[model samples]
Target: MVDVNSLAALLPDGVVVTDPDILGGYRQDRAQDPEAGTPAALVRPANTEQVATVVRWAHERGVAIVPRGAGTGLSGGATAQDGALLLSTERMRDISVDPVTRTAVAQPGLLNAEVKAAVAEHGLWYPPDPSSFEICSIGGNAATNAGGLCCVKYGVTTDYVLGMEVVLADGTVVRLGGPRLKDSAGLSLTKLFVGSEGTLGIITELTLRLLPAQPPQSTVVASFATLEAACDAILAITGRLRPSMLEFMDSVAINAVEDQLRMGLDREAAALLVARSDAPGEHAGLEVAEIAALCEKAGATEVFATDDPAEGEAFTVARRVAIPALERKGPLLLEDVGVPLPKLGELVTGIAGIARRREVLVSVIAHAGDGNTHPLIVYNPADADESARAQQAFGEIMDLAIALGGTITGEHGVGRLKKAWLPNQVGPDVMALTRLIKSALDPQGILNPGAVL
Candidate 1:
């Protein structure tokens, strides 16, 4: 057993905590893996130096360290291991926005929404907006390479990350890249670590690129009588031109949101789409008009357009709240599977088939324009048979995605839960190369053990 007293003495008082009650809370992240083990100690570091101290002590002692952000990860990437030190970056909330350079230097603990708000004060915007932006930390977003509703036009987390500060396994603090938009000086080490899922190193500070504030977006809400029609509209819209936001919710998700917000969503519609266009002034209106025509041509049951920001945001909020709304039904086994745009319809239909064959309820919502789908499998854990079925469906969905030449995860990292399917997606050679890199960077495997590899 490691000596807690010696470790505690090296840091400020209360930085190293071993209380059982406190340790319990850090054992699992939002993945909530039942098998997650109790961490030996929980370390709350305020800055990069403090984080390095914890890493150095753990490296010398061969103690495993699990780096965690806001604990909002859907994958089990932040799940704690037995006898490991859970290093939470929650207290390191600090950010400096540089309006001149259109960038923001932020500590890892700041929430995603806070980062957006900070940059907004300078008449700038951060493009990556995960649905949990309000609760998920910027560190976690980068760790997972998160995406959002607007990612169809803007791109994901990696696109906006100009640089970052990382603490490696051996306690070495390295700075990679910087605020410069273009840097070809070295290997793209910065991009490599962006979605490494804490297996490569712990991110301390990130220099994020910012854009001028977004223009007022015109919104289009379309309802379809069948899932197939909604998917047709998605492809048609994306094929024509890029939209600021394009989102999809099936009947399960639509009714779920309606149940919670009483927003008067078409509860009887088989599918709903919330699309947006942020082109300059009149162009925004023209884009939505074109989108509405495409939806109507694609067999939409009803289509509504609005230039009012408040009205548009209300629908965006409805799509964003689908997860929590469905959670009210039962515990969920979430699967993030994405396929090529052409295969979107096939994947959606295949998932429905899986739910029926497995005798489980699965609700799917997606950043439809980008072809990434989140299928929520609702099952009662109290039932042994139902729980087993849900687990089977989870693996099957990933298998289906692979069959269609798609990835196991789009934005969410392969954390522990989805690591099993990673090799299937990436062939043996890539897996071998991944292992080699992991071994070279973390020979002792002290950093985020059992993740990715």
Candidate 2:
């Protein structure tokens, strides 16, 4: 084992921490993986140079290094391991927005909401708006290639990422891509690391592309008596026009959100759809009116439209709080599964069937326009049999998604929780290629061991 005392001596004071209380907090991320192991020490690096120094020490000693960002990942990507060094980038928050170039250079530790606010001051927008944007770090966003509500129309993290500075396993720092809009460089290395989930390298800085401020949005809220009707409305809306945001929540999620927010949501509705349009001028209202019409045509139980931004925002906030709201019921086994747009209905219905068969409560909320769903499986941890059943249903849902020509994970990376089903979706050939790339980039295997590979 490496001497942590000597490691601490090498860095600045207070940079290395061995307090059991603090180390205990770093052992597991929000995923709460039961298998999370105790880390030897936690290191908070303030700059890329310090990060490289720590990586070099770990590389030399062949000690595993787990890179973490704000610890908000739904996947267990940042779970600590035995005898590993927990490298937290929470101290490296710095950002510079260049309105002239429409880009921002940000350190990894900046929160997504902080990045958005910084860029917005310059009349620019950072489009990727993950539900956890207020809490998640920008580095984690790039690490997972996270998508969100606006992604239905704008794009995900990789789309906004023009360049990044990454530290490889051997402590070599390299810069890939740049602020330019287009680049046909040697390889698409920037994108390769964007969603690597810290297995390939540790992201230190990102050069993000930004767009002009979004237009005022017109929102539409619709309720359906059945899930199929809501899905039909989603397909119709996406097919007719691209809405700025298209979200879905089932009866369980609606009730959960209502219980917390008391926003007067229709608890009797089987499913709810919240669609928004940010088109220029009167077109925004026109688009939402058209979407409301489609919902009504699809047999919606109730249809509501609002051009009032605050009222629309209240509904949007309700949709965003679904996960935490559902967690109040019991422990959750979250699944991020996605399918082709046409297969979305089958995916949701199949998950409901799995829930019934497994005897677990599954609440599904989705970025419906893009076909990515967050299936929150609620179960009582005190009951081992019930927990086991939830686990079984979780795997089965991923299997169903794979069978439906879909992916096991759409936005959230295949962290430890979903690692088992990755090969099933991508097949052996792609798995081999993935392993080959990982080995080539991290020959010492000291960077985020036992993650994707």
Candidate 3:
């Protein structure tokens, strides 16, 4: 066994922590894996060299290592392993914006919101805005390839990521991609590591591409009496034009949000749709009006549009807060399942069927434009049968998405929680290829063992 004192000697005084109390807090991430293992040590590295050193020590000792970002992952990607050293990037935050290149070089620990704010000083935007953007680290976003509200229009972290610096399992650093927008010079290694979920390597630094500030947006919020009506409107609005934001909430989710926000949301409505357009100038209003008309034609009981940023923001907040709103009822099993546009209605309906069959309270909130849905399955831990049903529903949702020719995970990477079903979704051949690559890159299996593969 590696001596605790020797590990402490490799890092700064406060950097290496072994207190059982402190280690307890680092054991599990947001997924709250009940089986999370206690790490032998926790190393909070403030830079790439520090991370590499920790990795080298663990690699040489054949000690497992779990790479963690902000511990905000819904999947168990950051969950600690028994007797392993947890390599946390939460202390590595440092950012330098190059306004000329329209990019920012950021350490992994910087919050996604901070990255946006830093680049926005030069009138730029980093568009991956996860609902947890305020709390999630840039490294976590890249690790999960996380998507959010603006992703419908701007794209996810992988799109904005021009380059990155990752520390491999052997503690050797590899720099992939760069400031150049178009780099076909290599095998797209940067893209490979973006969503590896800490299994392939630990991301230490990121080179993010930025865009000019987004235009002012016009927002529309509507409620329909039937799921069919809401889905029809989604088809109509999407078929006609692309909206910067297109989201949906089912009746269960609507009631949950209303119970919390009490914002006079239509409780009788079977579904709610929030749409926005970032078209510049007068075109923004024009798009909002068209969206309102689309909703009306699709049997909207109520249609509301706003040019007021605050009014628009209020609705966006409600949409982003939907998950937490539903979480108030019980512990949640969150499923990030997505399908092709045309198959979306089927996916939602199939999930509803599964919920009914399993007898679980499953509330769905979706980034409708991309057909990605977050089905919140509420359950009580004290009741074994109820918990079993919820787990069944969770797996059923992923199965349904797979049947619809969609991903088991749209944005959130498949961490340990979903790894069992990953092979079923991706097939054995792909799984073999994944294992082969992971073996080649991290032969010691020290980087985030039990995650992904």
Candidate models: Cα lDDT each = 0.94, 0.94, 0.91
Clashes of each: 0, 0, 0
Off by over 4 Å in 3: none
State TM-scores per candidate.
0.99, 0.99, 0.98
lDDT of 2 by residue, 338-408 (tens): 99999999999999999999999999999999999999999998999999999999999999999999998
Top-scoring candidate (lDDT): 1
Model 1 TM-score? Answer: 0.99
Score candidate 2 by TM-score against the native: 0.99
Worst 10-residue lDDT window for candidate 1 reads 1-10
Q: Model 1, range 1-453, lDDT digits (tens) per residue?
A: 667788899999999999998888888888788879888899999999999999999999999999999998888999999989999999999999999999999999999999999999999999999889999999999998999889999999999999999999999999999999999997999999999999989999999999999999889999999999999999999999899999999999999999999989999999999999999978887899999999999999999999999999999999999999999998999878999999999999999999999999999999999999999999999999999999999999999999999999999889999999999999999999999999999999999998887
Q: What is the lDDT of candidate 1?
A: 0.94
Question: Candidate 1 — which residues are off by over 4 angstroms?
Answer: none
What is the alpha-carbon RMSD of candidate 2 to the true structure? 0.7
Weakest lDDT window of 10 consecutive positions for candidate 2: 1-10
